[model samples]
Target: MNKQKYWLPVLGIFVALIGCITINTPIKAADTIHENYVQKIKAKKELVMGTSPDFPPYEFVKNIHGKSTVVGLDVEVGQEIASDLGVKLVVERMDFDSLLVALETGKVDMVISGMNNTPQRAKSVSFSKNYYQSGQDLLIRQADIHRYHNYRSLSNRTIGAQTGSIQYSLVKQQAKKAKLKGMDKDNDLILALQTHKIDALAVDTATAKAFIQNTNGLIRIPSGFKTSSAGSAVAFPKGANSLVQVANQSITKIRKNDLINKVYLPKVSKYMTNHKSKKDRQKANSMWAYKDFFLAGIGYTLMISALSVCLGLLLGIFLSLMRLSKNSWAKKIAGAYIEFVRGTPLMVQLLFIYFGLGIVVNIPALLSGIIAVSLNSAAYVAEVIRSGINSINVGQKEAARSLGMSRQLTMRYVIFPQAIQNIWPALGNEFISLIKESSIVSVIGVKDLIYQSRLVQADTYRGVMPLVITMILYFIITFSLSRSMKYFERKMGHSND
Candidate 1:
């Protein structure tokens, strides 16, 4: 009877505690679940906006006081939004196609590029009210303006549009009779049109006008295609209702004040006009004027390559040792990793590291690029190392063991040195490849040669010259690296002799 009384009270207390938790837990969770996207921004005191700087008038690089700054209509919109939210605006430059991904991955709080709210994109992200509505236009060579009047006029000719853009889909769906060519950047499409590769380049009215004004030998025409109301809006991650609300308020204020039409557009036009003046245009178009851009690009490219090579070498050694180990698990793991990394494309890997992994932890773009490059280089270097080690006669290891050297000592003192000597040339080739391939990091806005060249192209509106300069710079870097590698190979050869 006494035991029953004690146990009954204890059981009752336990039940009471459980009931309390069940009742209060949901309330606490609900409280915590209150949307705080705006709060987070306020706490951080900065609104990070992602954009592609190549699209002039919307977002483009400008050389102000010897500093390359991202300035345009989209930037002004982002600034307005940030100002309303009581935070500073921070811009993250990336490829236009990458802007949405960056927003989805939390790399940026919102994407304010010239992004239109389409049914397809709306499904993936929440967009604020339309800030700017622009009509579609076709840019053609000055001489071909009469040749192409509208989308229908280019029936059999090739029309170029930016890949992943609304214009790209517009051309595909409406101008079905025309051959559709897609490039990543509008500048490239303009170059294609100038070179006669594409007859017309479909772009926004503002972008087409900006290009025609700044770029020589290009003229704009109306793209008379039936389309729904398409307007640029700020994009936020899905279910970011709080952010969308604030962005809408800011956009509403902007429209109410006629800021976009009267202020922003005029300012953007002034920037474009300043670049188009005869003296300034001549100065800006000169390759020598962009020496700093190229030099900066080379510096960043070398930094990334050098760091990646060193880190990859260390990681490759570890992975190679693991693959060559006696333990089955280690060998299997190392083998699987090498195979997986080697099998995938480097661009995919770079995106994965930057955006995919970014969800778990925020990583800066440059660091992400270096990490991706190093991990990729490790896989290739691992293979080269394994081959070098395997090619060394079994006699060397056996002889080292006979001399009372432990297995680890044999690898450290005898096996590795000879393997490195044998692998020097292969390693040199890998190093050279690293230098060339590091250019891919520019896609993430790493400020490498390619990214800098794109900035120069945007700033100068002279696409081919920047490309030519970049190509020459890359050649110089690689040729120097190759010669240095050869000199080292010769020295190593002498040592072996």
Candidate 2:
């Protein structure tokens, strides 16, 4: 009695310790520690730069004569800032909206995404010197250019901008002001303009030129646009003053060297080809990454998803049987695994095993993703097995037991085969879910269909073609699975009849 009491308190303390450790650990939230982190970059000797590639003439990664290179004013300025501070540049590329989040996380040393310092972001990150400011404008076809008399001419016209850009913000404000239809995303913009889905677009002159060059048959209307009073600057997390001073001085150094004209201009301007008009170059950026390429990705997704579901089914049946066993510890272990996997977000689970596990253990990324997906799938699968086993009229198990059949013999010879045929269609549904969810694996570079489509879009800067192809591929794979499931369902029914 005394020993059991003593160990109970020790076990309680151990449990409390684990809870405290988990609670104290940092999560995906922004890095407030460096919120005032301006001083850290200067002292750290390692500068992390965050930029969104959609902004051109400012920050963009271009495929120059076959080699991909980051070019534009922001790149030129960011490199100088790192060199001046006696630190090396570690540039991080992400979506426009995510750039600020990176800064908020302190994952970035500074953000130079042609970002205008707004009061919202100011709460989290500090600002350095303003290098350049830009105003929004429109570039449209000459024949159709006259339609824009003012912001009102843009009304009812479809407009496009990269999500999270000041350009998008300005367009959204103008769309409300003039009652225009505005869409977010540079890719969406190119598609709208090329397909005549939008009458005109409202964006900056520089971004307009780059997008127009990226696609054919689209022009920027020279009239009917709003302006951006906002100015672009280097962003540091709040409370970082010393880093601000160092970065500001670096900008002053680079501007004087004429780096803007010499290096940045020629590199980006190479993509600025002369085109006749949008109609004449209709197929300009129309095709990329063969339709069959995504078909292969779809095939890969289906393959992994099918294998994972098969693995989950077997694991689920075994775990459920163990949960029904006489051993309390075995039941507890199975229950905990199911609860833990189901309680967490699938995305976090994928990242935890694929990326986080990489730090302590090394494994192929695809297998990591498979394990994450399988863990989550197994939880639901446990319930499915329990229900399937239950649906088999209890009299069947009773009669078998009465016939002198052992428990294991009855389960193997009688229960499983019928339960599987009955639940076969539901298993098909699980497989479909796994395939759709496989898109999350792309975050760890599995090169699944969705990731490949995005890479093609970024490289070519064409929005419509890659996505259109991807959709078709997904449809083909899912439709094929549905047909196969129904075929099996009918076969099962025929056997029963």
Q: Pick by lDDT: which candidate is best?
A: 1
lDDT per residue (tens digit) for residues 1-497 in model 2? 33342344345544754663354234323343344444466567778887765567777655444344556778878888877777778776555665665554444678897787777677767888777655666655545755765456766656556666665666676566443444434555666666666666666666777767665565665545445345788988665766777777877765677666677667567544433677533434344324444555777687668777878878888887866677866666676666666767998777656444443355555787788778788887887776677788888889999999998898888887788887787778877777888777765546578755755566567676788888887878888888999998899889988
The alpha-carbon lDDT assigned to residue 209 of candidate 2 equals: 71
Model 2 scores what on Cα lDDT? 0.67
Q: What 10-residue stretch in candidate 1 is worst by lDDT?
A: 1-10
Best by TM-score, which number? 1
Q: Candidate 2 has what TM-score? A: 0.68
Which regions in candidate 1 have their CA more than 4 angstroms from the true location? Answer: 1-34, 275-277
Candidate 1 C-alpha RMSD relative to the actual structure: 10.2
- Over the stretch 193-240, how does candidate 1's per-residue lDDT look in tens digits? 888999999999999989987888888999997678559998997878
**lDDT score at residue 390, model 2, on the 0-100 scale:** 70
